[model samples]
Target: MQPNSVSPASEKQHIVIVGGGMTGGLLAVLLAEQGLTVTVLDGAPAPVMPTGPAQLRVSTLTEASHWLLQNSGVWEYLDMSRVQPYDAMQVWDQDGTGEVLFRAREVGAQSLGWLLENGHLAAALYRRAADYPNLHWRCGVAVEGARREEGRWQVRAGDEQWQADLLVGADGARSRVRDWAGISGGARDSGHHALVATIATALPHNACARQVFMESGPLALLPLYSDPQQGEQRQCSIVWSGWPERIARLREAAPADFAAELQAATGEALGEVTLLSERAVFPIQERHASSYVAAGLALVGDAAHVIHPLAGQGVNLGLLDAAVLAEEVERATQSGRSCADSAALARYQRRRRGENLLMQNAMRGFQQLFGQRALPVRWLRNTGMRWVNQAGPLKRLFASQAMGRGADLPVRARPRA
Candidate 1:
């Protein structure tokens, strides 16, 4: 159904999702397109299209996420000019002489992933959803409470009571919906904070993403397009992680001082760095809900799991959650089962929970391994990195994983033939 052909609110199968960010927004569109009515309740107002250098809040979208968007018909609505695609990734240890390089060519792909502004993606999803005949969006509506009654969810927000056959909590790390559903999520701080910003560099990024692992933590420089007004393409987004005290000092440092530190930290790989946007700092932690589904309720995105941003796989995981959950919901509905059918929801959980857990553990282990100051441990890890870099078959496998092609894929997430 086109937006013009929307069924009356009372006549459609209603699914209400809290938090209309990227994952929730994409899930809303997917569900609505499958003939279920989806209402997205978001605390924040809708996002506007990006007009300049991307804001600090950006996501590194895996190739699978990009393909999912394209297959879902949301890609066309994006401001393509603002999207930055990188086909190569370089990871090196700053404390030792070890590095691993991944390239799309090894995986028979054009690009590994893209650096997308979160707002740009939200704007695109919103614009495309405007025509979803079954989608009902309410931005700036705070969900104050949620409960299950008579097997349906009743969400209270701003003097209004919204009921739905199924409810989704995509409300971010601290999700009210997850709380209402009694989901158990534990957060373990990495004792690090991430300082993110957009910056101008004396040298162009050359469409490559790079990360340098220092004792402080991993610092990533993702390529970004330059503002037309700047007359040069020497800008990039940086995510530098470290202890609170260290990040605080860096964040409070003079712009030039911080820029010099950035250049030094990255070995001046991109030459001189200049701040183009104010650096934003946030705590680094791993949070995962014990379960992703409960009768009539489900969780997606950060509300479900959040790993360290060292690999920038956070958004990619969330997009996959959206794809897989949507697939399960559609399958259930088509089988004459409730959208919240326990069996179907269990299937979704079974498929995603282990994979997410594996990634989380991997990140934690990687962090621990890198943080080890022991000479033997450092030598072993450096040797491992070097070995991984030179092993042709292993490099190909790593490239596929980075491209979002190694794991079990959803239909929409698979690249088109």
Candidate 2:
């Protein structure tokens, strides 16, 4: 099933997944697993761990994501030692009220989620992708332009043109395939920026993820695996969200000064903090495509939608999008349907669009509720959270959704339970 060995089936499907980042590479592996010829074109070489000053971004992997990766044949290959599990989550207002605690034990689960360095996940996917004989990896190549012809796509990038029966856009927030397919996107600025960095702590962390909501914004401290060099050393990835002006000041401050600012912001949630990397800021914005599929093309990952990171759901949403689309292709093929048929692609779009929309709306609602500065509104929200915290069933429901295992999951992702 190697790309060069692929022969014409009754109806062969040539799928081109552009932008070989995490989603793109993983999509390539999944599609190829369905016995389809997949070519993953990227503008850069393989993913690598950062050796620079940038804080290595981290992602919260829900149980469902872990399952998908495991089912997709990646879990066994990943460096499990670098991934840390969190059995509980603690959230409190920086104003020192509205405190809530959610434990996995309450839901009869082992861990609520996992904390993984983004680079580690990317590397794992890239390495696993190499084992898929049907996948063609064309690295260090950028798509200069693309066009459609004769019910197929003719993508021109670098010095080559790739012809495919259908194209998938996994190129991220500012996707070029979306542009080529004429998919329009609506975006709104959240008027905030997030400062992300890694910090060393003196406390044992106890496998709990913490988030403190300040008037400026929510400061999150995600526990990381213990430092390798120092046996007792602990570290946490910190994401400080706030206004643009304030973000700039923090980013410009000395490392020691910034660490002090972060410690005060978190109220020393995990104890003494020592800066471990250069602080980086990312603008918070909301974006969504007008449509996810058209003709012989479809959008996946950040190319299709983006939401506020208030709940750390962006990557989880993208992974779901990928899992659903790959499932649709398989179901269609098995049911004697055309992989590139408009009907099939439309079905994938319907499922993904609805799911992404719901999550986006929910995240926005949560952000609005938590971001309010009014005293009465704040008190009401605090009271509501307090009630929700005490409601055991309701807390489990919320935790399930955050774990990407809710009833709202796409039909393809639903388990028999």
Candidate 3:
């Protein structure tokens, strides 16, 4: 059978992406830069730069993610003053004496990773995407339906409609694009909920990210930059994962009572802590699509898979998906094939699905391992942590993975020559 092909003398291939969040927005900019006609349909309003106290939702950006933004011209649009770069990370068991410390200097890097408000990063990507003449970013437009028609995808939103050679599902976990394409995937409850908020510590975080694993779950204190005018760096973002009931109670607890619990959890490591923002709670679930691509469509970000947030690699994984898919499309286009070439899409799926699943299972294993209450298991884990900390090579290997360094990185994520 003859494959669908773009006319040699006519217009370039057209792609309609059904989401304008971080992943979808970045993909639009990438495909548009490759001379493809791209249109993004998002149900939410455009994101605005965040101000005032830090937002409850944030993401840790690794070096690979940083390079992606820098190479795509999106980094310049961000407000550097609002971004916090942490040079170190500390992980320990609250039930034992085992602890591991990772420093950027040990890896010859300036910082382990950066923390950015989700709103801030989204707005920056939106701003950079607006610069492309071939990209049409439409916010507040709900996607009513999507279907394959005569070798093309037709997307509808109310009275408007668009036809394209490719469709992308970056609509998040409950993605409408995935459903419209009839993709098979299900969510598995992790039997836990996470309480998130911004906090003011009595002592500064000292640009270090810390996590303590307890019987219930883990609590991560990720450093956030203080308001420049305040001249203090005591602000941090906290993600407390535990039983659903516990998270619910924490969410409803009085401010003083909550602060008291936090202080106890950290054992005064950061001194007295106070809540600086409203608390938000969300259930943790593990999700993975049986396949990431089908026909003329592809899934990216949470739409493809969702994992436990223990390692703060959720957004980083999504960004890598967008980059890899973009690279595959560009490769096919350069080789005189259609943008939705099956071989190209298969390569993308093969490259990303295994890695994402590996990370997902690894996080689940960590969660179960720490959740064990057996005395012997506790001693073994604690001992293992101490040994890894003392072993420089193993520690560096872990740090490199945390920094998103690997041989299979997409071109945009690779360091420049």
Candidate 4:
């Protein structure tokens, strides 16, 4: 198919976003809500409810993200029955005696955050976008190539061509749109792999999220909804980060043997862990683009940066990126200016880039600090955790930051009364 004819530059901004997953769909819906024409292209189909068991791919979304979803009309569409809220977090050092605890009530919040399948959010974002007239979703196709023509962006996908005054890359870590914009960055390898799976614990999860710093890396047992297949609610999602050699052993181990190792790793916190799903492993790495914007293009979410999963801040940060970009775009459109104008894009980068870098660095720092099995490093982290836990003000400040409320938030992401 021939490329679609390009729109005149003088016309209102027509935006085309690549990668229609969580971030792309979100940015599309938001721009459409601002009355801008948005076309989303992805090689994948829209998300729908799974037919069998709960999925292993999940994210921990903060209150700020929840607020943005609510305003975008996505949160209300989520299947709450599949959602689980954690009011508490228990983090401890495995090789040491240091441990710290956090609770939402200390921060005057009902629950800290939630754990939901990635597909659940994708489905919600897609369903919410369906109600908007300005959102033109073109799924099961990809942006073959993108180029700037006549001060606008034009992309080729198979036989079809879609042109827009502005373009965005939400295509994730290996973003083709970002490459098209000539953005490059060096990726840092954490030298670890994350193994994810669903398991039924010998004891109830008790609605608490737990993590333990082992010699290998950090292990998180995020509370998840019960399994519909089992007719019981005792399952939890676990993410264990470790070196490739160790991860391979677990991945190849027998199910029963893997369960025993997992239980031993957690110090038997939730009792024996019985694996309920096949363990999946992914290499962990940190990536950030040198710049988030080009002349007629911008990047958001994993396209711009990918952080360590230590704090589970990866998705929340991406959602914030979408919110800030939408806010900046709305500001420009209201002033009768191009939404992809240099000034507006710069504002978005300025607001989001610094925060993302901070989180990325923090995760790296913890990884390095905890990667050591030395007596001194272990002692230091444990002591620090003890102090942070014992000091009321310090603990509150950390909790607020973890909740994504310590800094100024985009109005679209602020919670409603």
Candidate 4, lDDT over the whole model: 0.86
lDDT of 2 by residue, 133-243 (tens): 777777677888879988888888655677788899999899989988888977888877998888788776788999888777778888887776434427788788888
Rank the candidate models, highest TM-score first. 1, 3, 4, 2
Candidate no. 3 TM-score:
0.96
Worst 10 residues of 1 by lDDT: 1-10
Candidate 3 Cα misplacement greater than 4 A, ranges: 1-13, 229-231
User: How far out, in Å, is residue 29 in model 4?
Assistant: 1.2
- Scored by lDDT, the top model is 3
Which residue pairs in candidate 3 collide?
Answer: none
Give TM-scores for every candidate, taking all chains together and pairing residue i with residue i.
0.96, 0.93, 0.96, 0.96
Can you tell me which runs of candidate 1 are displaced by over 4 Å? Answer: 1-13
Q: Clashing pairs in model 1?
A: none
lDDT tens digits by residue: candidate 1, 1-417: 212332344543479999988999899989989988788888898777887557898888887999999988899998777888898899999889899988888888888888889999998888888887678888888999988888888888876777888999999999888888898877888888999998888887878999999887889999986567554668788999888899999999999999999989999998977898888999997899989999998899999999999988889899899999999989998999989889988999988888888888988888778888889988998999999999999998877877788458899998878
> Residue-wise lDDT of candidate 4 within 333-368, one digit each (tens)?
899899888999999999999999999999998888
Candidate 2 overall Cα lDDT vs. reference? 0.80
How far is 156's C-alpha from truth in model 3 (Å)? Answer: 0.7
